[model samples]
Target: MEKFKITDLDLYYGTFKALIKVNLTIEANQITAFIGPSGCGKSTLLKSLNRMNDLIEGCRIDGNVLLDGEDIYGNIDVNLLRKRVGMVFQKPNPFPMSIYDNVAYGPRTHGIHSKIKLDEIVETSLRNAAIWDELKDRLKKSALGISGGQQQRLCIARALAVQPEVLLMDEPTSALDPISTSKIEDLISELKERYTIIIVTHNMQQAVRISDKTAFFLLGQVIEYDTTENIFSNPRQKETEDYITGRFG
Candidate 1:
């Protein structure tokens, strides 16, 4: 049930090396968290999984990032790869259009043009994001009009609309209130039953709350990776113990 296998990954932007030799295997239908301080390259590694770094001007990767045994950097359709692996950013970035349109956008791009099909996909995606009941009545309204938390959930719904197998979340709840953060945390926990989730989070408590596995990143390297319980309770590395114990990040 391995979803991703990364080995000897080294990423760079122009002259600066951003990530060092990294190796990890992400399992299927589980939540894996990348936690570290700012500029530790956790987010860079997350973006690398789906090839989001390709958009950067001088970004280069010298390593293997395999998705389901196939090299993602190999001869493959990038669009199709992206369709199967969706991402949600730190802030909720809903389209200026209606909520329904936002959810239907992915299916539409992938050639699902029928209204009936789009409607079903929209509703189902919203339900999967745990926001259908909240937004069903407001599908025609501008997505920008919703609260920040609702907007984030809508973004999640949009990611789900593509029927992706893996969902990459980059600090998904950082911009929300405590109540909103809790709601999204619950939603993410529920999502692991269907999608393999890799989240880059600065919040250690959030990782402990939802992730099945935790990978601690520092100085552009993964210091330790293990079950969340082990990483938090019985860490093998002094650095990990220092980090989890609030000694230093």
Candidate 2:
């Protein structure tokens, strides 16, 4: 099933075109990676999925972005759409509060008042993010005290607590150590069973390692998109082949 359908998406910041007309269908409950060099519109396209670009000054979009067959950009509540599609940034940005509070923040803001219910949601989200086992006893500790990787997991837990159907990540492990990066990669594999994931990553190896489908972008356009195996092994586009083979990017 297609969870998202983007058709002829063209984005602009003032007069500069950041993305050209692009069409793609993101499969439900799968990991889709947007791989490209810096400034190729990979991040811009990812932000469009959840309308994150709306926050940027002078940004404009021309096209249709359908979520579950509904046009999200047409008279829809931005807040509600965001709840259905959560986002994690390139950096781990946990709140300067207790770990429990950090995880519970979203549900609380959305009017989950009962302490018992909030507790359960927190635990479930943390477990889903693969951080509960390590931080169960330290739930009251400040999130800032945790390691960078743990902080990122906590951020993931916070996003999950909102019960989003689609999760968007932008270079989620870029700043982490090797071991931490591996853990997050493993978590991405586990997450695809339940939530649709769209990630923008510069790391070709990571994209090849964790994604079910890979999309290659160049000069603000989608050059190719296909199964991970096909993309890495036998891409039909010479540009994709060159990018993947370290010939040029």
lDDT of 2 by residue, 138-247 (tens): 99999999999999999999999999999999999999999999999999899989899999888989998999999999989999999999999999999999999989
The C-alpha lDDT values of all candidates are 0.95, 0.94
Error of 1 at 86 (Å): 0.5
lDDT of 1 by residue, 1-249 (tens): 999999999999998999999999999999999998889899999999889999999999999999999999999999999999999999999999999999999999999999999999999999999999999999999999999999999999999999999999999999999999999999999999999999999898999999999999898899999999999989999988998888984
TM-score of 1: 0.99
**In model 1, which runs have C-alpha deviations exceeding 4 angstroms?**
none
Model 2: what TM-score?
A: 0.98
Question: Which stretches of candidate 2 lie above 4 Å from their native place?
Answer: none
RMSD of each: 0.8, 0.8
